[model samples]
Target: MDPVIDVRNLVKRFRGTRRTAFAPATPDSLALDHVDLAIPEGQIYGLIGANGAGKTTLLKVISTLLLPTSGEVRVLGHDLRTEEAAVRSCLGLVTNSERSFYYRLTGWQNLRYFTGLYGMDRTTLERRARPLVDRLGLSRAMDRDYRTYSTGMQRKLAFIRAFVLETPVLLLDEPTSSLDPLSSEEIRSLIAEECQARDQTVLLSANNLLDVERLAGRVGKMSQGRLTPVESASDLDESLRVARIWLRDPRSRVEATLRTWAGGSPGRPPVRWEVQERNQRTLLRVATEEPERMLPEFLQFLLGSGLAVESVDLRSVDLEEEFLLAAREAEAEASGASP
Candidate 1:
């Protein structure tokens, strides 16, 4: 299958001015620097990174909101430069920027206006808006004025507006940023269900690692205007050698004992142990490679060293830590540092 979104060596720049004491100087800033990406149809692709990572810039270029300085971008087989109209017809975009809605108009009315612009008939508008409002839990507020709605409610309305036409490709930037936990979960579930049920292609940009881990089929990290693909959530978890261990006894000397063991081991990689109190119990995270092999011998050494033995438990690593480690490693390699 052909990629739904294909980008090759894409570049976008902005010219701005900086003021020195007596004069203003112009500088060229590159928002997207020689980025290459391919997003397959029917998959939820996550674009993740810290702010200023060019997530939004890439989205704008793909959605035809901004022109790239150079390179090729294609959406649904339409060249961004030559077939912008076709691309626009097939794409839906949602961003954190506040959208304007007629304050006096009811939610249903607002949707009707947008649907009319899309040339949707009255019956089709009702058919589409009704299910979307219900799915987004906006049934009660559908008849209320936009100005009276809370920020979260308005955001849900914006999302509903974007999906009303059922565009094949969706570009969402921080779709759940302002939502409460329950609302955020609801929206995420909807997006996931839509992707699976309709084979919709989605590119979601978010800073929330957990959200990406849960919803994305593939994850990519963006930094310095570049994007790099990453292993899937399961693969990332399996690649780590870090393990969390819970001891049976609450001994204050555990740290010293573990430190001695880590220092004495010649061939083993150095282990860093962090002790924390959780639910009034002690928890230790033993960072090392091959935890299964090391745990038995480490326990023995601890016992022989007179450290009280505690019931050992292993903890699972979450997606956030994995992302940070991956990003840091990539940054190090880019800066010519040893792994």
Candidate 2:
């Protein structure tokens, strides 16, 4: 099947001028480098990165807001370089930036202004906009001026503006940043339902991995403007993949068992297990080269050693952990090549 968005060796660079009259101009900043991606139809893809990892630049390029320095990008089989207008027309975008909306206008007015851009008739626009406004908890505030809304409220309005268009492709940057937990859940649920019911293809970039994992079918990690497709433990790090077993083990027995396992316990691989105590319960964090392969054996060792196992189910890798691990690997590589 053809990709909804295809990018090949794409690069984006920006030039800067000197601040001082006598100073030379600053070097060009490479916002993206050799970034290749293929997002298929109807699947949600997520990009995880730090503050300056070029995630926004890559998305903007795909939206044709910024042209690529080299390489190629195609949106729904249309070349971004040659066919930019078509790409823009197909995309529904809502960035987290505060400047995306007009604060002087009411939230309802803002959305109406955006829908009018898409050529939605007044009747049709009113029909589509009402439900979204309510679902996003913007009903009462819709008629209030945008500037009167709080930061979180403004963020919700941004979501409404982007989604109200109902375009086939949705480009969301930090889609749930400023909201409360329940509101965030609502936005996430809405996106999930949109994907399932509308067959929409969503490309989202977020610092929150838990939300990303919940929403995206596939995930990518970005570091220093390089993007890597991530699946399983090795995509981040073997040690980074871990499972926690929470159980109530007596102090004397737990202490002795941990010592033996840290040493050469019988029939057990020399893996790392960290023990923490919370609310009169113990959490044993078991680290392995491969979590799926070693989980059973570790569990057996725990039970066989006369300890109760409460849960091996609470094991997972989240976005913050994965992002920092990728940054470490990138830094190590750069340091090794320096000499």
Per lDDT, the best of the predicted structures is: 1
How many pairs of residues in model 2 come into backbone collision?
Answer: 0
Per-candidate local distance difference test: 0.77, 0.76
* Each model's Cα RMSD: 6.1, 7.6
lDDT of 1 at 277: 60
* Model 1: residues with Cα > 4 Å off, grouped in runs: 18-26, 241-317, 325-339
TM-score for each model = 0.74, 0.74
Q: State residue 338's C-alpha deviation in candidate 1, in Å.
A: 10
For candidate 2, give the lDDT of residue 284.
65
| Candidate 2 CA-lDDT value | 0.76
lDDT of 2 at 31: 81
lDDT of 1 by residue, 1-339 (tens): 789989999999987788789888877878888998888989889888767778999999999999899999998899999998999999888887656678899999998897788788879878877887888778999898988998888888888887777899999988888788888888888788866777889999887776798888888878768887867665665555556556655645665566566456676555445565666566666544577787777777778887655567555555665455545444544566432
